[model samples]
Structure formats: structure tokens, C-alpha cells
Target: MSKPAADHYESLASIPAGSSAHRDLSATELPSDGDIPRPVDLGDVHCFVQRHHLAHHTVVFEKAAIIVLGETPLSSVPGITATELRALQQETENKWKQPKTLYFTILVCSIGAVEQGWAQTAMNGANLGIPKAFGIDSNSKHDAFLLGLINSGIFLSVCLLGAWLSGPINHRLGRRGAVFVGSLICLVSNTGSSLSLNWPQLLAFRFILGAGLGINASTVSVYAAEVTPPLIRGGIAVSWQLWTAFGIFLGFVANTAVYNYGDEAWRLQLAGPVLPTIPLLLTVYFCPESPQWFVKNGQRYNLAFQSLCRVRNSELQAAKEIYSTYLLRRAQSKLDSREVSWSKKIAELFTIPRNRRAITASYVVMLSQQLCGINIIAYYSSTIFADSGFSAFGALLASCVFGFVNFLGAFPAVLTMDTFGRRSLLLLTLPMMAVTMLGAGFSFNIPADRPAHFGFVAALIYLFCALYSPGMGPVPFTYSAEVFPLSHREIGMSFAVATASFWATVLSLTFPRILTVLQPQGAFALYAALNIVALVLVFLFVPETRLKTLDELDHVFSIPTRTFIKYQLTEYLSWFTRRYILWQKNADLHPLTVGEEYQALVETDYEEEDMP
Candidate 1:
């Protein structure tokens, strides 16, 4: 019997045993043809990989045309020049560095974060005006509950409802398309809210708006994470949080300026988010679909390769990244061998240990984001400031201060996030946050008549925002965005966002009542206690996920849950030492530094042939 063409191609592409494993590799992992009996034509490498299942196990040049001289074997070529080799090396270097298209896409997609943030706190200020415009009596306890239900209550409920809807939207329209639809929904809802003459009309439109932004919230972060290189992924992915804080800052600025406008100013404040949405919709039209999404949908060449090239920056980098994408497709294809229903696929998200852990981690991180009490400050800071004895304008100014400090907080996050890594920062910040919340609780216990005491409270609040900025504020969203497999990234993030909003709604509906019953000090103390619980959750459940590719993570989480602690400690110590050295050089002198070993970043845990 004759050997098949596909099998022959696989043999040609396979690396030799003598070559260094990817973990110990010195240069590009692509080996020379020293072990081959005879050379194969260079022009056919991509075509063979595109059609051959086994060819996916090794890296190959994606663009055959770039090699030129179709009949020549790369190793046997007498005509190849130093310039051609240098051009290839330079292209690979550019791809290894940040590519413009990838960064631009990240920037444009981050506008979704801006819209989400704008909506989140806009109502915080609008609450002052909207209740008055409707002539609703908010004097009694019942009215206060109704007011909470109208403002944050409805928004968060549908926000979660929208998150569930995002799965189908991403599956159907893809991540970019889902973002566009969600942004349009934001524009329409914000426009409708501005024009709404009655409270019910505003509530209805806001509900729709929440659903739209929910879909966006679920999509944008993953869109950024999937497209970024592993080395710079954390820094770039954290842009989602940076822009979100900026949106919150802008919301505070707008609300402060319009506080004097009384009833109508709320309309302009509500409409503010639409400005960012317009540009996002315009630009996301040009951004590529996720390379994994393309491949999983069975596109082997065009869309998948192009998107991978844009995101990974060159054919070689794209080739390396696409190995994981190809593995994902191979896994999905195996499941397709039997008649796998949609319900089965959904079940696998939990039944598969790797995915199950990811979902659990995402839920914990997200719920912690809300339960840690940051949103209470973010969504109701003006209210919080008012209760602390500020005049209405003074309250707005204090909020502007919070917004400025909050914006400043995100700057340090971007710089340290990749270098210091996620787990170490979380461990440090969670404790710091616990202390700050405790201090704020004590501030509430101070007598309101003592204006001198107000400065202490104000200082605590600023310090809290400053401390919160670098870690708890951004890391959860950034982590959740990167943790899922490409197949589940959309729905996984939706679940994370939805879980966060669910808790947020719980606190929003109950917070005003908590204040009414417990008063300010008691409520602040309650938030402090909850933050402590959130810290415990982080300590126990979350694992370090720095410098890992998404597919690389598939192996780590696949290990039994019992082993999580060892990995967590290992990653933390690695970055802690690096950061300690930096701090020693820059700040406090500590001889304590990381003496560590990392088995290279992109090396796969599973053998090449062991994939589905």
C-alpha cells in the first residue's frame, strides 16, 4: 500500500529528536532540515499544514510566497541571500515586539470599557436630579428603596440578564460584532434616557442600556486579551480597566459641571457615554475577529491566519500562536466526532476540569470585585460624601477628587501589572484594601459637626482610591479576561461580569436600606468585614496566571485542584523577588530578592501528539 499525501507532509514537517525542546530552545524553535533524507519544496509548507492534521503539531512558515523561488528547498538553496534572511529575522523581531494593528485594536476596543464605566457612575450623580424631575416622593423609607430600584437596581438586573444573552451574541455575531451591537444599544439607550420625560420611560430605556453594556462588558476585555502577546498581554489587557477608570473620571467631571443645571443636567450626564460609543462602533468595524473564533468555526486559512498575523504581528509569531488555536480546533473536532449537542458543549464548560476551574476563579474574582466594597464608593460616592457632611457642591468636588485619584491609580497598574505579575499584587492589595475600608469605617464614626475631622475622612478616601487603583480595581477584570479557552472566552467573561453585577445589584438594592437601618458607621463596618472575606477568597482560590498564554493555562488548571497552592506560591515568589529588587534599587533597600527558576513561558505541558 502506498502512503497517503497527508502522512507524507506530516513526516516532512515533524521536528527531529536531536533538536532542543521548546522550553530549552535558544533561537526560533523552527529547526533546520538536517535530519531529512531529502528536502521538500518550501512553497508547499503552508498548504501542507493547512490540509494535514498532523502538520499542526509543528511550526511552519505561514506565507509560502515570501520565500520566493517556488521550486527551491530552503536548506538546499544556492540562490538565497543574507538580505532575505535578515528580512525574515527583522519581520520576526517586529512581530515579537508590539504590532501597531494589535495595539490600535486594543485601544479602540477599550472604548467599550469607557461606555460601561460612564453608565455605571452617571446614574450616581443623576440620582440627585432624576427623582426631583419625576416629582416622586422620596421622603420615606419606601421611597428610598424605590429610588434604589429605579437607579442601580434595574440597571444591574438587566445587566446580568444581558450577560446571559452575550454568549449567543458572541457565538452568532462574534466578539467584534457583539461589541458593535452592544455599543449601538448603549447609544440608543443613552439617547432615549436623555429624551425621557417620565421616570418609567427613563427606567425602561436604562434597562435596555444595561443589557447592551452587559454584552459589551463581557466581550471587550477578552477581545483585548486574546489579541495581545503573552509578554505584553497583562499590560495591554489592563487597558480595559484603565479606560474604565477614565470613563468614571469623565462621569464625575460631567456630573460636577452639570450639578448647577438642576433637573435637566441629569439628561446630559446620561448622554455622556454615547460620545465614546460612536467612535468605538466606527473603529471596531475594521478590527479582526478573534483568531481562535475563526479557527474553531473551521476557517483554516483566510480569516484565522489574517487575524493571527495582525494580533501575533508576523507569520512566525502567528504560527506559534495558532498552534494553540489549532489544538483548540482539534479538541473541538474530537467532540464533534460524536453528535455533540449545544447542551453538551455548555455542560463541558463545567465538567471539563480546566474550564470548571476557570469559571470558578472568574466568579470568585468578579464577586470579590463587588463584595470588596469599591463599587459602593464608585456608584454612590456623591451620596457617601453628602452623608459625611459636605454641601452638595462640596460632595461633587470630593467625587471629582475620587475620580482623579482613581484615574491616577490605574497608571501604576499598567506599569507593574506585567512585571510584578497578578498574584503578588492581589495578595498585597487585598490586605491594604481591608485596612483602608476599616479606616473609612472609623471616619464615619466621627461627629459630622466637626469639620476638622472631615479632612481625615477625606484623606482616607483618597488613600483608599490610590491603593485600590493598582490591584483590586483592575486585576480581577484583567484576570477573568485572560483565563478562559478561546472556545469559552466570551461566555466565560459574560458569566464573570454577570456574577459581579449580580452582587452589585444585591448591594445596590440593600445598601440604602443598610444605611437607613445601620447608619453610616455600621454600613462602612459591614463593607469592611465583607472585604476581609473577599481577601480570604483570593488567598485560597485564585492562582497566579502571569506570563502564560491562554492555551498554556489549559494545562495548568487541568491538574487537580489540590496542587493550586504550590503554583500560586511559585509564581508569587518569582515576581515578588523581581519587584523587591526593583524596590530595593528604587525605594526601600531589602536584600530579600527572588532566587527562582521559570521553565520558559510558552512551553506546552502536554506532548504535541497528546492533543485531541
Candidate 2:
């Protein structure tokens, strides 16, 4: 082994293993002595950084170490000046002031999101023209089935192949390489889709496009999360949803612009997504590879350090983060000493308690994302508008307005996701989503000849999209990307994405018949009820994960599901009732106390000195 590798192993060996003693603590009871295993101490982490980092011998390294520990007196550390101390403090305080390279990386990821949104909206526009051009009767049951199949073909491919492929592709190619390959496939498949002579040909190309969407969707949020700092991670990670909304809006604009192009307009709409892929293809290679990817793939500490430096404003911040990430990986590897085979990793996602809880949380968010009925609007809003008595041009315009609402709604999350938190946002928005969807569905009850009917339905649909953009829209991907340990992150995310894609396929395939049988009223009511169920599940299962480092999430997920549920039901529920329902102004809800095992692994006793 190389000297650094040898030292790395030695560092792992020196850290104490967590206790295996089992305790049957009650759900509401706080853990007492020996009830939970203790994580590695922060002093040990400081030691690891000092020993392994080549720059540790310098005065700058000393100051960086003190800042990282967050407790050391600057005067106690030799060779540290007041000006140097001020710079270090500024790095943490002004969290948004990141390196230019980091912003560029987020931009690359955002373009990838735009590609995904544009691809989805292409079909939304094409749906209006394709059935007629292919001689398929939308009113015929058999033809309706065929139309649904064609519409859902891409998502079926995503669930079956693309989501599952993300892990191995990421494992082999790294995040940037996976994105590049996915974008290339999209470019080719989108062209093929536009040129298709028949429905079957278009379906085949759509399936190919699914492969790209699945890969990009699974990889981009993770890439963004890995590169971002904990303080601003939510805002940065949410760029995927935010830009995707932009892309959706642009796709609608394209569809409206080409509505006058005769029967071939659908073909042009289907090709609209191909534009964003070109920029994604050209620029993706320039972004830095994820530093966490390096740490997990191999003990490439030097390369990890370099990658971190490119994204962070200072080498000191880079040094602090790399060592912190490295230590957590080491701790996780000790806990899970199994083989690294794909099948084994998949099994671990369920078999391990920490991972299982993460899967449960991921499932709650991802499943809810689909069940909240956003894709129903995304895929078939034009058809819905048309059915509600809109002209072909009017349907396209109304859909465009819907897309604009979706895009504008996402900006709030960029501010609130970190402050309001992931779980809180989901809980807050779901009930509103349910209410708006119910209102929209019932609005169809008004007479078609009345102007209020059109105004009410359109207004309610827009409101639903607005509510969805901030909460379920961004949280699932961001939450799924961060919940799993580095060992199983790719596979865990694959499972989560697969869950979403599978349900999207089901919704796309069945909604046409649903609209036929149940009409708009019943269809909307069913999904509104589903939104309530999703809200209940979120209340019971999903844990809050905002503002925590990817490594720190291990502790959050380590708390038993039953324990978390118990706390929510007994503590949070009552608190909510008293605070909101009863209108108690001074009601306080106690924070959930974690065992030493659940505390942040990198926390130290060092206190920050006041900076002049």
C-alpha cells in the first residue's frame, strides 16, 4: 500500500468501534447509557486531518484545524493572526459565497434538469396531434389504450432499466461521465422521436429517451448535493427542480409557437428537448467530479482534496470537508464489511436498519411525489384543458400558463427549503395541494357555456401546480440523494427513482381511461384523496434532513422508524394541535434528543472566538 493508504488504515484501526450492546428502549423514551452506540469523537477526526494532510505542517493548516474544530482559541494556536482568523470565520458565515467553479457546476446540473423537463413537455404537446395524425381514435377504448401505452412507454423503460442502470453507470463512469453519456443518448433518441413515421417508432424512441431521463434524474441531484456545503446544500440541490420548471415553461412556449405549423407541429414539439441537450453535452465535462465519489470509489484522498478545493472558496474549507467525508466513510465501511457487489448493495438497502429507514423515508417522498398527481398535469394538462372546452390553440396556451405557474412556484423553495426544512415543507404543502386539486376537479361541475367554468378550472389547476413546485417537486430527489450512506447512495437513489418512475408510468397509462370512465370530476377527486394519504404517510415516516451534511444523515436515519413515528404522533401531533389548532401563542415543542450514536460525528468542543 502507499504510505497515505497505510496511514489511512491505521487511523481507522485507532478509532474505537461502536458498542454492540442491545437495549429495548421504548419509542417515547430517551436513550440512556449504553442504549445506543457512540460515534467517533471529533478530537480523533482532528487527529486524522493533522496526520494525513500534507499541509498540516503549515501555520495556515493550524488555523484551518482550529476553525474546523470550532472550539479552539486562536491565540492558543501558534502563528495565527487576527486577519487570517477573520477570513476563516467569513467562509462559514457567508455560506452562499461559493467558488465560481461550484456555481458553474450547479449550472451544468441545471441544464441537465432542463433537458429532462423539456423532454417531458414535448410529449405533452405532441399528444394533441399524434393521435389524429396516426388515425387512432382517442374516443375508442382500444385506441385509448394504445395512446396511453405510447405516452407511458418512456416511464416504463425508466422503471425497468434506466433507474437500475444509474448505479452501475455512476460506479463506472463517475457523475460527470454518466451525465455526458445520458445527454448523448437523449440527443439521439429525441431526433429519432421527431422523425418517427408511426406511433410504434415514436414509442421506441421514447423508451430510449427514458434511459437518458432516468440516468440524468438520478445523477444530477446527487452530483449537486455532493458538491454543495451543508449550509446551502438545499438551495443548491433544488436547482434541479427550479431549472426543470424553466425547461417545462420553455417547452410549452415552443409548443405554442409551432401550433400553426400544420400536422407536422407535433414533430417539432417532440424535438424541442433536443436543444438543451446540446448545451449539456458541450459543458458537462468541465465540471469537477464529486469529491465524495472519489472517497467512496477508492481512498483517493489527494484527488478528493483537489476536487473539494475547486468547489470551495478556500483550501481550509476543502481540508475540513475532505477529512470529514473520509472519516465518515471509514466509519461506515467498518459498520458494513460486506462485499461490494451490486446485488449485495441492493440487499443492504433493506437489510441494514439505517439504510432501511432511509429507504422508507425515500419511498414516502418519492411515492408521494407521483401520488400527489403532478405528472398527471405535466403529461396531460393540454388534453385536460381541451376536454374542458378549450380550442386546440387555447389548450396549448392554458398549458403554457400552467407551466409558467409551475416554474414561478419553485423560487420559494430556493429560499425556504433550508430554512423551513424538507419534512416541514412536505407536510405544509400536501394539504394545500389536496385542497387545490379538489377545487379544480369540482370546478368542472360548472356549465361549460359559462365563463366562470373556464376561469375556475384553469385557476384551480394553476394553483395546484403552484403548490406542488416547492414541496413535493424538489424534496424527493434532494432527500433521496442525501439519505443513504456513501456505500449504498447510488443503489438507494436507484430504488427511489425507480419507485417514482414506476408510479409515473402507471398514472400516465391509466389516466386516459380514468378520464373516460370517471370524467374529470372523479379523476380529480381520486387523486385529491391520494394526496391526503400521501400526507399521512409523510407525517408518519419521513424524517427531517435539511441543513445536515450527507455524512450526518446517517445518525438521523439511525433512529428507529417506530421511535420516530412514536415521537411524531405523541409529541409533534400534540404540539401541532396546541400551536395551530388551539392557537396557543407560547406553546413549545421539544426537540428530539438523539443518543451519542445519533449526534454529528465531526462535532468538537472547540468554540469560535469573536471576530473583530
In terms of TM-score, which candidate is strongest? 2
Residue runs of model 1 more than 4 Å from their true location after superposition? 1-99, 135-139, 153-159, 307-342, 549-552, 562-612
Model 1 lDDT, residue 195, Cα: 90
lDDT of 2 at 41: 35
Off by over 4 Å in 2: 1-87, 329-338, 548-555, 586-612
Best candidate, lDDT? 2
| Colliding residue pairs in candidate 2 | 70-606, 71-606, 71-607
The whole-model lDDT of each prediction reads 0.70, 0.81
- In candidate 1, how many Å is residue 11 off? 12
Candidate 1: clashing residue pairs, number: 1
Cα lDDT, model 1, residue 305? 68
Residue 565 shift from truth in candidate 2, angstroms: 3.6
User: Against the hidden reference, what TM-scores do the models get?
Assistant: 0.78, 0.86
- What's the CA RMSD of model 2 in angstroms? 7.5
lDDT of 2 by residue, 344-437 (tens): 8888777667777789889889999999999989889999999999999999999999999999999998888888999999999999999999
